[model samples]
Target: MTDQAHHETTAPASVLIVDDSRVSGRKLAKAVTALGHRTELVSGGTEALGILGEMPFDIVLLDIVMPEMDGYAVLIAMKADVALREIPVIVVSSLDDEIESVARSIELGAEDFLPKNFEPAILRARMNASLARKRFRDRELDYLRDIDTLTEAAQVIEGGAFHPTELNLASVAARDDPLGRLAKIFRSLAEEIYDRERRADLTVRTLRGTLLVIAAGSIFGIAPALGRLASAREIPPLGLAFWSAVVAAILCLSFSIGRSGLPRLKLRDLRFLTLWALLLGCLYQLLTVVIAAHVEASLIAMIGSSRGFMVFLLAALLALERPSLQRFSGLGLGFAAVAVVLLVQGTGEDNDLLWIACALVLPFLLSLHTLLMSWRPRHLGAATTVGIMMALSALFLLPFAVAQNALFLPSLSFGQRELITLALGASTAAALVLALDLVVTAGPVFSSQMAYSQTLAGIAWGMLLLGERLSPLAWGALVFVIAGFWLVKPKRAGDDFRITLRMKGNG
Candidate 1:
């Protein structure tokens, strides 16, 4: 029992004994050391304060009266500062018998009063009690500080600057609190969110590349048939545009099941979708075909090729797509190709410029359609959007076609001219529009290359059906198109471009 009691009382604590008299200070130090506590003796308050600043002590044994700096002064200084305020001070004074003196000392932050002839047993109890309280306070201070750190971390997360491993998890390893677990949960959540965003971004890039390739090929297949229909017949551009949209819409609309329906769209989205349909699907289509009737079909296709670059520029300006040196170079080369074609074999200076001006409008309209697709709700599936645009195009053209007397029959009967429009519209235009949905996602510079493919078909059709021919410079312009392709195809994956469109070199 005696040994256990001694063990309990003797847990080592560093104590500071401050007195001006050497004898008093040594006596207190010796008693504290005998009690199995470590002690340091200081002759004045200034020395005690300096030692306390350098080391951590559980208690300070101070005298009320000293030569220069007194115990009362030391206590006042300690209480004034937060770091030293917690060290328990027991003033050693005969004045402990005076109630007012003890009260004054206690009020100045002394933990207890010690008589000049202090009893070892009483001293042991008072010192040990003060030591126990100080240790508890220390843990609480640490815990509170850790909580403050967590608050700062929360602010950082809210500001969207969260770093996955920013927090020192080890700080809480020994802690038994809910906040530690909370910190770990937040860390996990942040990582998961960032990872998901990364994956989604990759998916969009890949999907965009794929769409551009399809649009490129699809546009080529139909331009020849379109040139054949537009030139050999008297159908107005409005009628041709409307009929093509009608045929394409019938094909695309069939695929909208299981996806979000167009009917469910909000009023604003529905209205904009209609406007988009008119601008690109109806009005732009009419203008391109009308212009194609006058200009050489291959030249029209070449001029229309600039649509991709136009969209690229718009997207970059809107902060939707990043600008790159390769993309700019490709676009620059493409325009130079357009200028080359116009300069070398332009029909008549005034006529060529006029027709080219009309063709230029088509690509700008196409750019708007691309932007709308990006801005549109994703749940409105690509097929549905295409179907909606085409349906509206056909409706828009109905009145115009009737006024021009240009619908269903070129002469109210299925002739070669009328048959070509049906085939062009149903098979080629439908496929082109469907492919266009993908092209919009792919991006402008990539999608514009479709015009390059169209140039080849336009040349072939113009030769076979309309006896058109490309000038020698037109052939060289095609090579620039190839250079443009190489410039834009990124070399690596997840480097902001994943699935790549290596446009099959024109056969």
Candidate 2:
């Protein structure tokens, strides 16, 4: 290193001398300055505090007998201010007051006591020790701050929104220590992951996302038919919903455990989870199952097609979505389509208007569930979250099912009803997993297109599996619903999955 750089490396600490006697203060300043350190002389503790507030100093030499504010008062003020609390203070005292002053100074957070008529060697020794401690503390604080940066960087990466240059580890990486080595490695790995994601093939990603959408939609489309089948076998709606949720919870939870261990739940998360259970597990499922028995599956699916509209409506109401002409027009068309289905198709002999109106609640409940997902706990795997929600849903349904004596258990033969119920559960779990995958891979805008596939698949499955047919007006309504979905959908993914980090209460 150059001479200048070497000198900078061994630079002396900045010392502040506080004494009521100007002569004594100047003498102490001269002594400290002669020791290759910088010094500032203050006539009283108040002046010392003023300078300390204006700039940072490595140490303070305080006089016990000061006017207005004494050394003890200054020490109390410094200790109370978080910004100045860590700066070392060495109290200066006379022989007469040395014992009591040192004892009191130490009790008031002073680092050390120095005799006013001290030897040069003793002064040098005490000052050196205090400066060394200060330097070590400053280094430790820097290291911890850098550690926090690294932790935040990791969280950002896990949230699927990482960018290059987000991790601030350059200073930490410069040090010649194990921590520095770890910082270098971590930065390299994080940047590599970012580059890989940036360089990923767009066409490949799109294809994978499309496949997931179709698979999720096709699986979801069969749910109405499955519920219809279960209902036909005299299965009570609550029993079917409860059994299916239990099956899904078991499958999802087992997979989660095998992959990443059980999730850690805080009390704060229970509110979100319980509300989600109410919307999806109990209300939506019960309504769909009950309506499936009275209304045709195809018509039910068509009404369900208004889900995007409901989500958009709720998002706008919550101020989470911005208003736009195209989106508003799309919203209008969606409502018109729903109107056609209810007024034109529901009035037909095959479908009940009451059940059709009941099915409308399904999409509203779904929209609420979708909004709720935004506030889910951060850093949880897709399977883990879904597993917990399903499990919570089962817990919520258990008491209701027991009270009604409507619990449905499969026979030893594992017949068609059992098979259908298992299929329903498996399909729900698979669709949710695929949907989450698509959202992450291709973004929510692309994934929202699943509404189209779901509607078409539901109608197809109803015809093929249940021999249900749709009226001409119903088919037209489907077209309008698809168009409405296309219009209402945001051109760009607005906010991707929001990872909420909520702290638990003391309880």
Candidate 3:
């Protein structure tokens, strides 16, 4: 490798190394300094944050499991800052293989991750890579900012006359090959159209698949509830409540399938995720079957659905996409409010425990689904892959449904039949609403705001149609959820709150 000092020193890149280990910090500092770059060593994230406030650094080397403020908290703080958010952070920690932790770091806007035990060469390489990436990103930003100027200059002479005429005359005088020029123009146009069409097709397929998965999964969740309602021959007091856990699970799965395809298999690209999905899918089915044999169907369904959330969380962690804490917190708050409403209204002894279990598992499954969808293979059509996966899941569940006689068709009066069908239809319809909502509010809007809106809508609908009452706890939960989401709103320069990084670095 070339000496760091030998590289151009027009603007010496700055690096801050934050670690609890004095030895590691000093070593990293030395390595960075050797490259003719300015380096600072801080013992912990708090110190690093303090330094960040005083001086701007081009990159940060963070340790994951630090004292007081861990790498995650620090990264979050950095991203929250307008000045620091632009600086690329490389996580240097021992928790390299800890997939969840790594994924969380990435989600928190960390640019890269590295292990503490990395070889000197690897360390040097990583540092250089980080700096290079930052430079490229800066260059792209600058280019975009001055694109009009660049375009105008390229097209016009100093006096603002078109340069194309002069270039054409010169080309003619030189007798340049016309066929070669025509071929180049045709090739460029074809390539552009091909790229646009490919993107459009992928988007269309992903959306269609997302809708189908939600519909199918909802049918799976609601079918059992409908059967039970028919068996009991009573108006299910908690129609939405009974279906909530299942709806949540189907929603999480739909989100995952929509964001990522069901049949998405990338052995070389996040193999851990593929393994996790396969393992979780099996575990979920096994657990559902075992639990169904011993427990009430509703309880089994609730617990099973909750477990699916946990799987979703694992998937998100593995995918390395940052969880919108605001969004998650909002979801949590909304659930809490719903819980309060249920408790005030619920008469059953076992209902609370089942609900709690379902709530606990919801975030994990949601995260998992989000992560899986984010990394869906470009080659596979999203709708087709999702359809296949849902079909497979149905096939897998068929045996359990059959053995338990959960497959029994219920004879019903007109109203009961209508309720059952509505429940089934609602699940699918809700999934479509969710996908549309995601597309609409993806950037800038506080997760809490979205949650608050959803909570209000649910409460309003319940009150108007079902005559359901919201207790004080529901209101309290709503307040907390909204407040949390507002607090996490991204602090950036522009009004646009989208968190996209410069893609040109990899290019």
What TM-score does prediction 2 earn? 0.55
Q: How do these models rank on TM-score, best leading?
A: 1, 2, 3
lDDT scores for all predictions?
0.68, 0.75, 0.50
- Model 3, span 139-202: residue lDDT tens: 5675454444433433433333222322232222232355335434533543454455545544
Candidate 3 Cα deviation (angstroms), residue 109: 58
The list of candidate 3 runs beyond 4 A from truth reads: 1-359, 378-386, 409-422, 425-469, 472-480, 489-507
Q: Pick the candidate with the highest TM-score.
A: 1
Scored by lDDT, model 1 comes in at 0.68
Candidate 2 error regions (>4 Å)? 1-212, 326-348, 437-449, 470-507
Query: Candidate 3 at 267: error in angstroms?
Result: 11
Model 3 C-alpha lDDT versus the unseen true structure:
0.50
Clashes of 2: 0
Model 3 CA lDDT for position 233:
52
Q: How close is every model to the real structure, measured as TM-score?
A: 0.56, 0.55, 0.34
